[model samples]
Target: MNVLSLRNVTKTYQNHTAVNNISFDVPQGSIFGLLGPNGAGKTSLIRMITMITGVDQGEITLNGKRLNPDMILDIGYLPEERGLYKKMKVGEQLMYLAQLRGLTKQDAKRDIKEWLEKFEASTWWNKNIEELSKGMQQKIQFIATVIHKPKLLILDEPFTGLDPLNTNLIKEEIFKLNENGASIIFSTHRMEQVEEICKDIVLINNGELMLEGEMNAVKQKFKENKYSIEFDGMLPAHLKSDSFSVVEDTQKGLVIQVKPGHDSNEFLQSLIQEGIHINSFQEILPSLNDIFIKNVNNKI
Candidate 1:
């Protein structure tokens, strides 16, 4: 069940392509990561999805219907930039934003109260927006973003600033929101967040789709033949092999990048012959950051 689909979407500036023939589908009720480095056109694609800006070519669909004005109410967006009034009272700001999203005053108040309590920020209701910390105000804006309970939520740089504890708090809320059947499109340059929470991802680099698919499959696809081993046995200090190259070595262990077209069994058998005690050995899979670097380099 794909909740959002972009088909051959292309956006161009006066002399440069911002997004080039990008296409991907975000499954229903899943956390989808939209990732890219600075100036990679990821924001352009997101803007097109939210219809904040129109694409020069291609179409975007939500809930099996073409993108339209009515879809705005169904899609709630928290842009990379904050969108709250600084001088307004916290509670008053939320109420105004909620109504703009098409919620009735009574319903918005009820939901805002529940959300404030859930976030344990109900006591700050009367605080002036400028009185709050950046992270605190971020939470208030976050509450407004999802308070309407839209079927689809688009959050860009959702965790830009915060102490670890508050970051964890919002992470918990995001997980809970997903569990309640809301599809989420999480856009951020933070690769670790994508690795930690996203089930699928679409990466764009320099105005083109670099990759898009299940997280697990993408990791496996970009996997290199490598392993990390921890041992204390007296293996030869000057050890080298054609099949395996030492990536890093320490008194405790060694990280080896195995060469392609080599048999793992043969390599291990050689280690056994050399009397190296293998305490623990595990294959090395490319992290999201690693994959991102490889992707950008490939494009270059």
Candidate 2:
């Protein structure tokens, strides 16, 4: 089930097109990655989805209904730009935001306290936003965003100011939210994070949709049939067939590229026959960063 769908969505500003005719679906109860380099229209698309901006053409739907102001109540958005009122007390600010999201005063207080405690931020509840560090403010913002238990959560560069420890904490919370039926749209320039958490992704480049699919399927589609081999002895010349070539050779291992029509099993046997005592051999899969660069560079 898709929690959100964009159909031929296009957004333009004067002579420039921020988001072209791109369409994608965000699956329900899953961590979905919205990825691209800077100026790739990702922010424009997100703004439209959050109702911070409107589309010039095409349609966007949330849970089968047309997106509008009312739907914003069902969505929790944490933008890359921090928007906390600097002088406001953390606890009071969170309570206000939660109330605006339709939570009762009592309910909001309970939820805010629970989230603050979970983040180990209870001690800073009385501190003004400006007094806290950037990472601390980020944690408070995140707590406020989800305090109302929104069904759809959109996070853009959510881990920007967080250290490794805090980043992991938020990541665990994201997974927990998905488990509890919240559909998340996680936007980031960090491909490794997407690989670790997202089941599906939509990548954009220059306002165009470059790719969209399950993470594993996209990786498989772009696979090059390369393998990394580590061995004690040097590879024999006879084992190097016309269909196989060493893309890289180092003290650690050899990165071998297997051409089309080459048999992996036959390649392995040849190496064994040559008396090469293989320590390890494993297929090399392209990372999301690799694919992102390849696609974007190719398009450019």
Candidate 3:
């Protein structure tokens, strides 16, 4: 079941359409990527989803019901722009945020303590937000966001100020949350991170939906039948074929694109017939980064 659904949703600002008839579903318990280039209306869409702003057209639903203010407590949002009071103590800040999300004082205190300790941030409770580094402050904000144990999490550029260690630390937590039945909408410009974590994705450009699907399925949809073959000896300097084209010849391997309607097995057999001892052969699917660039550029 989809935890969140947007149907023909659109938002406009001062005669400019920021989100134009966009629609997508975020499945329950899935790590979904919400990707778009800058000025492509990602922020506008997020604002609508989080109820920070209302859609000018269409509908948004949570758990099959029309979205309402009561549903806001069920969503945990970590905006790209972090919001934390610099003068506030970390513990007090978290408690305040959690209470606002409908948690009881005692429950908020307990959850806050557990999350801080889990993030190895027990010592941060007494520290003012300004006393922490950017990464440290992010951890505090993360705790506040999740302290109420919301079912849907919208994280935008969540790793921005984090180091490698802290990045992985938060990544592990994200996975844990999803595994424990939370649905996540991860938004970022980092395609590599999306590739590693998201199972499904949607890309938007010029305020329109450009691409959407399961990650592997989307890659297959954009694949050009390219294959990478690793062989024991050097490729024949005069190698030529009408069935395929060599796109790259390097020390690591030979990357070839099979001509349309040509079978990959036929290409492999032809290489073997030419006396090349093939060690490994695998299709090189287009990366999300490659697909993102191609689609966005095409729209432009």
Candidate 4:
């Protein structure tokens, strides 16, 4: 089931188009990536989805109904810009935001404490927002956003300002939320994170969808049929097979590009018969970053 969708969505500014007639669906209980470079209309699309701004054309639906005022509670948004009051005490600030989300005072306080403890940030509760480090503030904002337990979470550049350790902290929380039944729309330029967590993605470039599909299927579309084989002995000049061409050679192994319709088993057997003792054999897959750059260049 689609938790969120846009049909023929478009946004235009004074003599400029930001998002242009794009449409996509994000399924319930899955992580969806909204990706693009700077000035690529991704921000405009995201704003429209969250209703922070109105669309110039088209319609949006959430949970099979037209998006409306009441639906905002069902969605949580963590924007790139931090919005906490600098002088506000962390715990009090969180409690206020939670109440704004419609959570009762008692429930909000209980959940905020749990989140703080889970992130190992309990010590930050008494500190003012300005006194906390960037990573600490991010953790606080992240906790505040989800304290109400909304059905949908939209995170834009969610991992910004976080170190590797804190980044993973938020990542684990995102995974946990999905496991407990919240659909996430994760938007960022970090393609590796998308590859690691998102099962579905919609990529936009210059106001158009560069691509959108299940992450694995989309990755398959960009495969180059490359493989890395590490062995203990010298490799033969020919494997008696034209299916693969050795692209890189080292003292320990060879990296080859297998031709389309070629049999990898036959190639491996030839290596084996040549007395090459295998240490490791693995297919090489392109990362999303690699594919994203190539696709963007192709479109340009």
The Cα local distance difference test for each model comes to 0.89, 0.91, 0.91, 0.88
Write candidate 1's Cα lDDT for 1-300 as tens digits: 799988999999999999999889999999999998899998888888888899799989998888998889888888998767888999999999999999999999999999899888989889999999888988998998998898999999989988898889999999999999999999998899899999999888999999989999999899887787887675575557678888888778888887888856766777788887778888888999999998988998
Who is ahead in lDDT, 3 or 4?
3
For residues 19-124, write the lDDT of model 2, one tens digit per residue. Answer: 9999999988889999999999999999999999998999999999999898888899999886899889998899999999999999989889899899988887
Clash totals, every prediction? 0, 0, 0, 0
lDDT of 3 by residue, 70-174 (tens): 899899999987879889999888888999989999998888889988988888888888988988988888887787788999999999989999999999999
TM-score of 2: 0.95
Q: Candidate 3: TM-score?
A: 0.96
- Which portions of model 2 show Cα errors greater than 4 Å? 273-275
1 or 3, which is superior by TM-score? 3
Tens-place lDDT per residue, model 4, 230-294, is 88756665663678888888676788898888867878887777777888999888889988899
Top TM-score hit = 3
Pairs that collide, model 2: none
Candidate 4: residue 82 Cα off by (Å): 1.6
Least accurate stretch of 10 residues (summed lDDT) in model 1? 232-241
